[model samples]
Target: MIKPGSRWKSRVCTAEAVLIRPPKSEGLPQCGGVDMAPVGEEAAPADMQPGLDQGCVVGKRYRSEATGIELLCTKAGQGSLGFAGAALDPVEAKKLPSSD
Candidate 1:
């Protein structure tokens, strides 16, 4: 269960994220096509699997409607974020109208 302030690190890439909106069910939040573990955990065999490799942009917001999850990119990396084989869509910031 990822909390609103929970942070996760990528397993294969130098990616990091913070959860804003979490899913109701326990859905694995993945980066580079692989599940991301908590920020701190016991040292385990590193996973060199490549996911989207398209890369993650810093300050970009990624969301998944199916699982009602949203995350903020803290650090940029050569990996794409997604879960369950579905790539998460980037949430574009809405533009403000100019006041003449």
Candidate 2:
């Protein structure tokens, strides 16, 4: 139930859905393919702009290509949280006991 003008929320749902989907073509090409560049990158074509915009949740989780690290955009709750960090703060990362 998104409002008509709530394009941002719509985009967030779309992006989350895509991330949850199985790779279409298979192999590395499907999952994070060479052409499937990170959001806000020049390598990402204009056609993908709409999808990326819709997918990206401001002040939320985003894939950082440079460091290969997934960093939080802002404090939790303000933005849609990723699967692991749904309601958690980055400080909680260290609190979780390792399975090792």
Error of 2 at 13 (Å): 16
| The best candidate in terms of TM-score | 1
lDDT of each: 0.80, 0.26
RMSD to the hidden true structure, all candidates: 2.9, 14.1
CA displacement after TM-score superposition, residue 43 of candidate 2 (Å): 9.2
- Candidate 2 TM-score, C-alpha based: 0.19
- Model 1 lDDT tens row, 1-100: 6689898888878888888898767777788778888888743435544547777889999998888888888988777887766678999887989879
Candidate 2 per-residue C-alpha lDDT over 1-100 given as tens digits, one digit per residue, 9 for 90 to 100:
1121111111122232123222222221111111232333334322322212222333443442322323333222122322221221221334567798
lDDT of 1 at 74: 95
Model 1 spans with C-alpha error above 4 angstroms? 43-51, 97-100
Best by lDDT: 1
Q: Deviation in angstroms for 24 in model 2? A: 25
Specify the poorest-scoring 10-residue window by lDDT in model 1. Answer: 42-51
